[model samples]
Target: MVIGAGPVGENVVDRVRAGGLTAAIVESELIGGECSYWACMPSKALLRPAIARSDARKVAGLRESVYGPLDAMEVFAHRDKVVGHWKDGGQVDWLDSIDVRVFRGHGRLHGPRKVEVTSPEGERHVLTARHAVAVCTGTRALLPELPGLPAAHPWTSREATSSDRVPERLVVVGGGVVGVEMATAYQALGAKVTLLVRGGGLLPRMEPFLGEHVAAALTARGADVRTDTAVSAVVRDGGTGPVTVLLEGGDHVEGDEVLFATGRKPRTEDIGLETVGLAPGSWLDVDDSLRVTGSDWLYAVGDVNHRALMTHQGKYQARIAGAAIAARAQGGDSALDTGRWGAHAATADHAAVTQVVFSDPEAAAVGLTLAEAERAGYRVRAVDLDMRSVAGAGLYAQGYRGHARMVVDLDREVVLGAAFVGPGIGELLHSATVAVTGEVPIARLWHAVPAYPTLSEAWLRLLEAYRG
Candidate 1:
């Protein structure tokens, strides 16, 4: 049995069924999950047009033709099309094609390898997994507690991404991926955006230079990016008026709508964790095979485990967990391949997690940053370069501005991490992920040449600097 029929859950069911086992998936909401509707799919749908127009605006001859604002209606229509008009019929059909049983309800653990699903009409179904049960319930936005904030009708990630119309003025309350990406999308779609970051900068989890370049680009695009700002209170008259946000310094700001993208908390609460010797609302601990600690028949994948709070990472873990379940079911625990890079181990989550932020002058990173590598007790050297120095980058965009950094392990002379901040950098991330995951040495990287007059040429420049 698998709970939470998101991409991770669906993948888990797919893999286990491929192993010749019967499987069932339970979901209370849409079958395709958050990424299919509200989060990744719709959010990226809204941002892509803005990014394309911005890319065109950078080229000399094309800049004049692409100066107008994005067509909000057409953009929203395209977004609706991409998200299947907020329906899950196609997803359900796909699951049916795969021969996986779908249970429509809220599913929770009842004990070892037992699942209880309650339908919307108060009907309950009990399911017993022959081998293992997997939890793929992801997370919801974490909203901070401020006076009257709950009554103010603030938009979390769900509403921010799925809204039908863009607000005239939007006040964003965090500087993380969701906040910045939504701000960029709405501002390009014609919202006057004011970004509030309680921290000193944006994307604090990434290398400092990546955030610095992103902040500069956001400002250049006319977003009011404020750092070290906080909201203490909120007021919305009758829950249908402009939101009035009271700041800590006794100042106030009002906007047509306010978005709180502070953070995320796992959706473990009310999932019956207490029935299984585990605390309610706590992140599940798991091994490399994704088996929940202290239990062989239980596994947790995705954000519910708190391993890596990303859609792609969760899918990767699901594949590993599903394979492990099949192996253990057929040939006992001893047959499981739990070694690093093994068929059933999620080794890349620790040293090769890759991410790409779709903000203008996109930010992409893979593996450990220089600071993380040093803290992990590795001798490392970081080589930094102005991305504009690459001839291909200049040709890609007139007056291009960007930065790239590669952290090399001095002891082994291999790339530990690489961060790229510039236009067209998203696609360059996989090369770094491959290098970090494969442990490819710096000398071997030299033989794998990057095409000339492309953003990929930045790799050659970094290698030359490392040699120097």
Candidate 2:
């Protein structure tokens, strides 16, 4: 049984059914989950046009023709098409084809191996799992505690991604991926954007240079990027007027809409975790196989596990957990392989988590940064390259301003991480993910020659920098 029929839980059910196990999934909201409807799909749809136009303006002859603003209505229409107009009928059909039972309502742990689902109509149904119960309920946007924030009708990630009309002025309050991405999209779609970052810079989780490049680009695009700024309070009169965000220093910024993209918290509060002797609102602790710690039949995958909050990583964990459950159901411990990088182990969660921030100068990275590797006690060296130095990058864009870094573990002579900050680098992340997760030796990487005159040739430049 799976609770939360998001993409994570859907993948779990798919895998379990593939292993000849019956599955039932319960969801209180949409069937396809946050990524399918709100976070990834709609957000990227909104960004693609903006990024495409930005890239076009960088080209030699095309720059003059593409300087016009994007058609905001068309962009919103495209986004709506991408998200299937916020409907899940097709997703429901897919689940039906897979033969997985779908329960629509709030699902919670009734007891061990039992789930009690409360339907929207207030009907109660208790489901007992014969094999395992997997919880894939993802996280929700975290809004900071600020005065008048709740009453001001502040937009969370959900609202930011789903809103049809762009605001005349947008005050984004975070430096994280959601904040930066939304700011980029709205600014391009014709909004005066003020990005208020409490931190010193943006994309603080990645290498410092990545954030620096992004900040510079956003500023160049006319975004008011403020660093080391704190919001003391937010006030919106009548809940529909311009929002005034009061800063810590007695300064204030007003916007037609204020979006709080601060952070995320697990969506496990009312999921009946207390019945299982676990904290009601805490992230679930999981083993390598994604089984909840201290419980054999209970599993937690996706954002709720707090392993990696990415949708792709959650789906990866779902696959591992599903396989592990199948293996154990057939036999005992003998049938399972829980060793490092084993079929049933989510080893990449720790070593090779990858992400691509779809902001105007796209930031893509896999595995660790140089700081992360050093903190992990690995003897690592970071090799940096100006992406414009690569012949392919110069051909791709006029100025072609970007940076790439490869962190190599000196002891193992393998690539520990790679970060690329520039346009058209999102697709380049998979190669780095392969190198880090496969533990490909630096010597072996030298032989994997990159194709000439493409952005991918940045790989060769990165290798040369490492050699130097």
Candidate 3:
């Protein structure tokens, strides 16, 4: 049994059936999870075209000349197409093809191997899993305490993704991925955007150079990006349009929409976890097999587990949990070691998970930032470079002030982390992820060729700087 038809849960069910096992899936909302609907898919779908347009303007200087105006309606229609009109009929068909049972409403554990599902029409069904129940219930937004916020209606990522109307002005609170992505989305949608970031800079988890580069890019794009700023109040004065958010330090920001792109919380409050001896924060604690800490037949994955929160990471976790469940059902060793790829092996969550903020002049980092590298007790050597030397970047972007950096382990002669910030660096992130995860040695990495004049050349340059 799989709870929450999110990317992780859906992947688990598919893989379970693929391994010739019977599977049942329960979903309270959409299939394909938040990424498929709200978070990754819709957000990126909105951002990608804008980015392509931005790049076109940068290279050919043809902003108004070549592309006169974009139809947001048409654009949204295309996005809806990519999302299959926000319908899970295709997903349901695929699941049925694989022989997985589909149920609506919420699902939770009743006991060791039992799951109780509540349907939308108040129908209840109990299911007994012969192998295990993988919990992938995902998560909910975490709203901060702000005066007047409740009374004045605010849009979370959910509202932002689903809304057909683009507001005149959008004030985004929180400078993380959601905040930045939504900020770019609204800005591209013709909304005057003021991004309020509580931290000193956007994507503080990334390298400072990347953050600085992205800050400049967003500023250049007319986003009123402000870091070291916190939201204080939300006021909805009639005729004043919609929510007006008061930021810290006496500055006032009013917007037709206020998006709380703040963070998220595990959906632990209402799940049936407590019924099975779990505590208040009943996001099931799991073992190497992803099996609940003390129970071998109960496994957990996705946001509910409080692991890595990205959709990609969640899918990987699902694959691991599914494989473990399959092994257990087939009388294979169930001592699932996450590092060994059997027990919800999102090993990258701890070892190295690359994060990319897809706004213009994107920010990216894999493994650890310099600060984290040092704190983790690595004797780290760092190098920074302007990405202009890369042939592809120079040709693609004029007046580009791109930057790249590498955090190296002095003892191991290997890169501990890397960051690239520029117009097209988002695509450059995976190479770093490969280097970090593959533990490719620096000398050998130098021999590994990057296509000439390409943004990939930055990899070679980073290696050169590291040696110096």
RMSD of each: 0.9, 0.8, 2.1
lDDT of 3 by residue, 153-260 (tens): 788888888778778888889888888888877788788999888868887767777677777777888889888887877899653477778877888887888889
TM-score of each: 0.99, 0.99, 0.94
> Per-prediction count of colliding residue pairs?
0, 0, 1
Full-model lDDT for every candidate: 0.91, 0.93, 0.80
Q: CA shift at 135, candidate 2, in angstroms?
A: 0.6
Cα error of candidate 1 at position 413, Å: 1.0
lDDT of 3: 0.80
For model 1 the local lDDT of residue 296 reads: 81
Report the alpha-carbon TM-score of model 1 versus the true structure.
Answer: 0.99
Query: Model 1: per-residue lDDT, tens digit, 52-155?
Result: 99999989889999999899999999999999998999999988988999999999999878999999999998899999999888898999989999899899
lDDT of 3 at 433: 88
Comparing 1 and 3 by TM-score, which wins? Answer: 1
User: lDDT tens string, model 2, 323-366?
Assistant: 98888889865898888789999999989999999998999999
